[model samples]
Target: MMKKIVPGILTVFFLLISLQKVQAWGFWAHQRINRIAVFTLPPEMLVLYKKNIEFLTEHAVDPDKRRYAVEGEAPRHYIDIDHYGENPFNVVPELWSDAVQKFTEDTLQAYGIVPWHISRSYSWLVSAFREGDVDAILKLSADIGHYIADGNVPLHTTENYNGQLTGQKGIHGLWESRLPEVFGEGYDYLVGKAQYLDDILDEAWSGVREAHYALDSVFNFEKILTEQIGSDQKYSFENRNGRLVKTFSKAFCTSYHDMLDGQVERRARISILRVGSVWYSAWIDAGQPNLKELIKKVKKGKKGAENKDEKIEEEKENNGHKLKIIDRESSDLLGMRDVHEMLFGECEGHGMGVGHGHGRPNKPHTQTAQGQKEGLWPLRMRDL
Candidate 1:
């Protein structure tokens, strides 16, 4: 009886251990992009933004949270442009209607629509500005920031996004979450002022196109590095936020960072500028409304204007673990849990949404994620 029970327990243990949760561009990076983007606004825009900077930063990860709760949220975060063609832009129509007409909404969504979604987000922000709707402006700004940051990530552009196709699984979290958490402090955040976009849709598509161009390097560098260092050395288990996590070693991350030669930093910088620029453009297009007056008109909702430091305090206590709430967003917060191996036994309240935490299996990082063998696909498409 004892032997039988022990084997059953061990089987359950490995099963849990094998389950992995994937997150996109770490939560820290996403929030940081939104927070810093505020400073990039000109005085006209900055006046309003600086007033509500806290709201923008805290809500930056809201889009990721919506993935679990909201329908069609996953596809908005990324695009498997590679699925369309080698030269994706050339084959896929630039306009949303044209794309839908060509591929049908179901097929377009069966892949992803991040670039087009950015355009939609931009338009909403413009409307918010035009109407002086403070709530809409802030919400849309935070959301648009999330999408633009996703667009900048090379991993977010591919069919083999998580490296499952090439046996380099976990690369998604490694590149987006770990690298920035380890080395982002040194990155310069002063990206100058935001500028108006003459062609919002064009720029949105450009971001996705450029990201696609860098896809090869994103995969090859990791593949080559793993071969040189071996997986054991490439990844190391260390204590993070009071738990042991298997993540890329500093040496390994450094080597990979060097190989990318500013790719990650460049992408992050572009995300910051784009976020700020789009926000600024929206304000200008809205006829430069008086944001102070607009703020007064904002309706009080479920949560009042709580202390801005609430999130900061939470971050300090959790060491950024709160953001990891399984379904929240991508960051070390959602690093795979070792329930049986750890003294804690089981994760108490790990993820944010229903599918989050211990009960549910990990969902794919993007809805349109393909090449699902070897558990590489964390982002899932319902149709596929």
Candidate 2:
């Protein structure tokens, strides 16, 4: 009786752990998007981004981590376009000011503001490039990549993101997380070099529209496959991190992957190109700053113990603002918890909806393009 009880307790404990992981199971894709985007950069911007590849890759999921810790952070990760109606693009205004005027800021926050947030973050990235702030540039680059990647996910754009409303719960992780975890190695990521966008806002909307267009296929394929397969064949326990964890069976994933007809790979490839293009555009907007100089300055600043003392003094002069920036950079290096691992424990509460803490109840506060020049960081760093 005691031995049996111990096994039951362990199963319960692991299930709880898996639930936490499902919330962030998509972190791997986010990190992969940022990492691969580095290769898409041109020689000019590539010099800086490539040197700090690890920083960009690791911090790609920083926004996801802030979802629970930061108040307004969750809304930035997604937008529920379906909440607007059948023709959301026509109903919702493209410009942030226009959207706020039409829907009221509170209403907008209650839904989502991802596209607008992407535009806002792009402006901030441009400002960082112009100011030649290495820390800010790198941080914002990683963050914008995360948002752009989210924009490409069909689930991130819908009200029934996790399929809770359709009774096919857990489809979110199955599509975005498990499928990639199993077959991503074979997916082609060579999306070609990044191209410049004339209007970043238009580009952001286009990506969201494309992803939204694929929304039906995302759900329909899974439903069809579910009907054909029994529960035992649909899911299986596998060893992950030295623990038995339940996940979508490889055979089921393969069938779903085939049904999608390369949709997942296509979206991921587009995300990579878009991320790199945005980074390049920001640099171009900043008058094509010599990124090599910024790299040199960073190297110079790290030279000696004497220079470190001077850095401390400089931070004191700036009221520790510089120290705060350094601390943030250090935190990125130390790495945050991968939200994907939390999915392995339990799969509940993973819905990307307004009520599930995915959207902010209060209005979002953002800096104008002009304000970013004065070093006004947006909600990302402010709430953190």
Candidate 3:
């Protein structure tokens, strides 16, 4: 009885591990997207975003947490486009009302409403900005970024989200979670400034449409590589956070990444740009309230805001690697001094012309609720 029970327990443990792995974009990727999107905002919005950059970055994964803990949360993370028909783009209306009119709200919700949720999140953000509710603005901003990022992921747009349908049970995690974890650090993230979005709902739908189109390649490439490489070479066990766990081998990930030929990176970049633009647009629509004043008020009321230098200094002391944490205050001062002398330009109170620091330090700069080191930032915050 003991022997039989032990084997069953081991099987359940492995199964739970696999289920957990399939969560959205891995936690690190979601946080990285939110952190980078901050840099893309213009000075008006940047002033506001940079003040609460930590909040925005840290809370980016809240929606994922809520999916498990809150009712009606899972639908916001994905949409099974193929469920609608051959051309989901043509069949599905862009507007929320039109969509509900064509297909009842229950039907839409049953399928998933990620694209619509993106638009709803945008509106909520705009309201938060207009009201100047610092907490609401931060929470909604982080949440919207998550939905938009989810919309950008090809797997999130498919019915075979976890790939249980096509004998590719783990492909969802492999594509969105694993590929990015292994190869993402080296990809180019120099996405340009955020432009104002004219139609938020249309933009959301466009993202979903584009992601749906990429689904075939995401599935086919992995399946092809699996058949070629065989299982032994494709998987290996390694220590992660002090636990021995099985995962796709580096060689397998590299081969699959190569076969995709930059789809993952392309989608990530697009997601970053879209997230930034949508945030900026919401601020503008809300009459461009003074985020600076609000932040100042919040800071005064809340004691013990982490000192920027202390955090960086602590990181510098403990980090084993050579990578340095770019000093935000000094970097801004230097960037402004250079800009003023070179261009004879006046620097804004916010560091607009100043350059971005390199992406998050080599070591984790923050901790998760679980007390584990959260990952680094993906893009440098602009000096502005």
Give the best candidate by TM-score. 2
Q: How far is candidate 3 from the true structure (C-alpha RMSD, Å)?
A: 16.6
- What is candidate 2's CA lDDT for residue 40? 93
Question: Between which residue pairs do clashes occur in model 3?
Answer: 351-384, 352-384
- Candidate 2, residue 166: the lDDT equals 99
Strongest candidate by lDDT = 2
RMSD per prediction, one decimal? 15.2, 12.5, 16.6
Over 268-313, each residue of candidate 2 has an lDDT whose tens digit, in order, gives 9999999999999999989999999888887787765345544221
TM-score of each: 0.72, 0.76, 0.72
Question: What lDDT score is found at residue 102 in candidate 1?
Answer: 95
lDDT of each: 0.75, 0.79, 0.77
The true-versus-predicted C-alpha distance at residue 369 of model 1, in Å, is 53
Worst 10 residues of 3 by lDDT: 344-353
Better model by TM-score, 1 or 2?
2
Identify the runs in model 3 with alpha carbons over 4 angstroms from their true place.
1-25, 297-384
Clashing pairs in 1: 324-333, 325-351, 326-351, 364-378, 364-379, 364-380, 365-378, 365-379, 366-379, 367-380
